[model samples]
Target: MSGLNAPISCDLLVRADAVVTQDAERRVLDDAAVAVRDGVVVEVGGRSGMEARYDPGQRLDLSGKMLLPGLVNAHTHLPMTLLRGFADDLPLMEWLEKHIWPVEFQLTEELLAVGARLGCAELIRTGCTAFLNGYLREYVTGQVVADCGLRAVLGEGFFSFPSPMFPSAEDCWKTVRDLDARFADNPRLRTAITPHAAFTVSPDHLAASFELAVELGVPWQIHLAESPSETAMCLEKYGKRPVELLHDSDLLGGRTTLHHCVDVTPDEIAILAETGTNVVHNPASNFKLCSGVAPVQAMLDAGVTVGLGTDGASSNNQLNMFRDMGLAALAGKVRADDASAMNAQAVLDMATLGSAKCLGWPELGRIEAGFPADIIALDLGSPNLMPVFNHVSHAVYAATGMEVCMTMVAGQVLYLYGNFRTMDIQSLKTEAGEAAKWVLAAAGK
Candidate 1:
């Protein structure tokens, strides 16, 4: 973490009239102000008490709004925003084969960086402070995220054949390590092992990814049991289900986070819990791709740590946490047929704390004295926020990304009142458009 600011003074204090601290007590302090020091929250209480106790360097007024911890998108593909509306109305395999894969093959360094910057713009505007992004390559995506002031756990998509970045298996191995070393001392970015999936990554490649993850002390993200076709193929080729194969291969462990456990059995859920592995539920992606509903409630009931994610805008159509929470909550209750299947408060926690845990970040999620001052203010004056009976309930059911008035990460404000503070979106958009033209032509579109 050499490039990280050396944990300096917080140098900022923010006062929001309505502070929604999603702590164990679920305290919502009125006329509250938060004190932040060295990028961490030092105190949260009444404005008078805080002003009297500490002299503030910078004070921000967030009256008529609700302050909560910045959201955590447990999984995403940041650069995939360029392909969002580029491909639609197809199943997972069909979409990938017909549209996504072709464009991915034509993705140049410029295209990758522009797409990532555009995605970063979208995330900052929508109040997402951090995300776990699995990338096809590393150099450009890492640089874009670091330059744009966002945090992502990135990795090379361990593919079996050729890739836009890595042309061969040897190239893949070299790229992962090189990217890991490049970002090893980085503050805002860390590299993880992102094997495409069991369907694409052979056993040898997956084992190598696990070894690399352990070597770098990073976590792993991979698609597991996403479709019945995947499990059936694994059974045909490897004589076992996808989860069973991973378990027998010694890759099913705490350091692994699997995506879309749709075809997994109850026993597989037990294995995830027993091994401390996590699962990411992308309800919108599943529904759009017709991948079937994941037994997420079953996984949670089995003590597995579950987090919410918008797989990618291409699959999800949007990257908004409010909508993600809505879909996540509805997905559970619809499958379980229980009104109390996933509480609104629990879904909010999933977007905040639970997703943080899945990414191995401890200080995020909580609005406590020692947590990072990554916070957001949602303006509750919109028609949706009107007559709010419960703040948390309104946040889950009524709110949308448009209500976010500010987004702060590491005690630094990146977006405020619909305006991004750190980057130039117009220039980024123009550059991305130029690269996308090349992409579309190269992709034979």
Candidate 2:
């Protein structure tokens, strides 16, 4: 053991003007610092206290910045970055069947990886250190995420019908098994069981997938009640609403995340809370597609765990969690017709802690000691962030993703000042540009 007087060695010491600790107490410390060692936060306290106690290999002085835990994207299709702006102003089913699905079917494995890598760049740039992704060719997406040093839970979303990647429903399960095995020992990567949704995936398959997720002790995510049409279709086919179907099937639980619950009723909200099922609110995508706003305030009031997410770039047009955070705050107020609904701090919390809970990562989305050092810095020097009355307010209301100056995952700086430390941004952009052309042509867009 080291002597009492000796300064403990740490990998990095990050000092900022203020640290927003979204802990249970929601403490905001001024002139605070966080000490990281081996990807974990070893200490977090006043800057002078940290400086006096630890010797850091590297020091990051974010004097004009506010530090917060890195944002978590609870639900996203990372590979859909290639489909951004490819389809817009259409309903969810029309958007998917007429444009997104066709284009997705044409995406080669190489293109899928490229799109996922580009999405990772966007995520890192926008201060997201971790994401829960559902997409095709998820192994490729997982490898890209692993190489880029971001934490992710990747799942291959499958339907009752054969997909481009999987020839049969059985084949999809085999792929999930392979993914679970491949990422079993990885700290930064894992796999989820993602049956597409009630509309596209049969009840039997959804149950089987849920069982596999339970057997592997992994999260089970699926798109649910995204639009009115989905609810109508599910009710027409199964004599129950989407959430009710899942609840009846015993699929609603703490480890299950239902994305885009835009059409759920008050009863459904209560059901979600009672079952401990998590929901991801995708405000931007929902609005863009003309899907009614989710009953977020009702859900919150009923004690439902709600996380914020950018559904996919194809529909949302961006993967920036900050954008979604702002939208979630505003949409909730608009939906509830009360300005106090989904306040700035509440939305910010949804993006971080709530999203972490959705992913079943208890140790993530906080800046406390013993937590992973997944943190981000926002440059308070920006004009939009001027005269900051409240850091949390500015973070959720005023600051765009441009204010993010640094994004770190597990003590590793993946993005800083427009520079991606893990991936080649320029080359990836070029390849994505080419891929977009190919996708447009293939989709006859």
Candidate 3:
């Protein structure tokens, strides 16, 4: 306390039993406090040091809670919340071509908005403060995320064939441009160009989408090697693998985030590393769809930046990052036949800091001075999290998303003590149910 400054004023002071700063050093401080001002963390130190330095307008005493940076969901399809459990237990191609695509052809803007609302609510309750969303009608999704006080990169899906959202590929481009312009200046919402997949999109369309992404200076996302059938199709049609096709089209680079590289080869993994392209692993979704496990440990060994994702509620059946972390660790070990693979601390890093790097947000995913105050509190009093001997082990192996009692983004509490300050969760649930019913009926499902 000798080095502490004279008492200063700030917006909020959050004190907890332990502050798990997921920084480069991975330091976990005991009896810690963080002072936030203007949505930025001004200080993080011992409780006595912070209390001596700043006089806060509001103080939250989380005596029985553990503080950590909010989880970053690197990839998801938010509007698919309406389709959760609508179709399951099928191969990837059959699931998409027969059921998912047909229902998506019946989605209206209002229905899409309802689904986005539901997804936002679920993500907030589960300690996710930011996400990368790839789906249709992204403007609606962007608005919903903005209103819900969450940070997101919203992407509009593009395909060569006509769909319910757009009549032509040009129509999809127009929507992307419109969404980009609308959210260009927004602090909480950003835009991205998303082509459904390499196999589904024509070469010309993919080239145009990448050019547009470059022009807009935003990241581009695409599904790559999600299933064996997809890899087979790419090989049969293009005389190359999916990654080779993207590289040939000049689409593989630092600004690209490829989701589900479950079938990628060693050479492709090296290419991904050399080109600085990011990979997102959706373990639960892949396992559920029988798509085979992604070589996450191999990717990490190849120096590829890998992050964790839930894919979508439809495939994952939950928007919980805690479950994703656990599954990622377990799957990595099983896939590698080594208990040392994807240790608990590494999985936790993938959920927070690693995902932030994938999103190109340097100031997020850490609790430290000058970083954005994106934080969450987990109830340590929970029975499962009791007798915590190791912070990282407890967080990754034992604690579930239900233990997250409060979620804050940019120093603002969005959900606290089971109450949402920004959105109406009950109304969203009712509306989402209605929307799901309408879409199912429209598609005659």
lDDT of each: 0.82, 0.91, 0.89
Tens digits of lDDT, candidate 2, 291-350: 889989899999999998998998899999998988889879989999999998889889
Higher-lDDT candidate of 2 and 3: 2
How many steric overlaps does candidate 3 have?
0
lDDT of 3 by residue, 1-445 (tens): 3345558889999999999999779999999999999999999999998887788999989999999899999989998999998888988888888988888877888988888888999999999999988998788999998888999988889788888777777788788888988988878888878999988889898888889989988888898999888989999998988999998888888889999999998999999999999998999999999999998999999989888889999899898999999999999999989999999888988898878777767567889999999999999999999998988898899988999999999999999999999998778768977886786797686
Q: How would you encode candidate 1's per-residue C-alpha lDDT over 1-445 as one tens digit per residue?
A: 3234333234777887678898879888888888888778988899877766666678888877889888888888888888878878897888998888887877777778888888888888777888888877677888887777777778677578877666655567677788878977877677778888887888988897788789888888898898898888899999999999999999987788888888889988999999998888888888889898887778878988888888888998888877888888888888878889877887888888878877767567777898888898999777889876788887888888889999888788899887888789889878877876776787776
Task: Name the runs in model 1 displaced over 4 angstroms.
Answer: 1-10
Q: How does residue 93 of candidate 1 score in lDDT? A: 86
lDDT of 2 at 149: 94
How many clashes does each candidate structure show, in the order listed?
Answer: 3, 0, 0
Candidate 3 clashes between residue pairs 3 or more apart in a chain or in different chains: none
Better of 2 and 3 by TM-score: 2
Query: Which whole-number lDDT from 0 to 100 does residue 435 have in model 1?
Result: 74
In model 1, state the lDDT of residue 243.
90
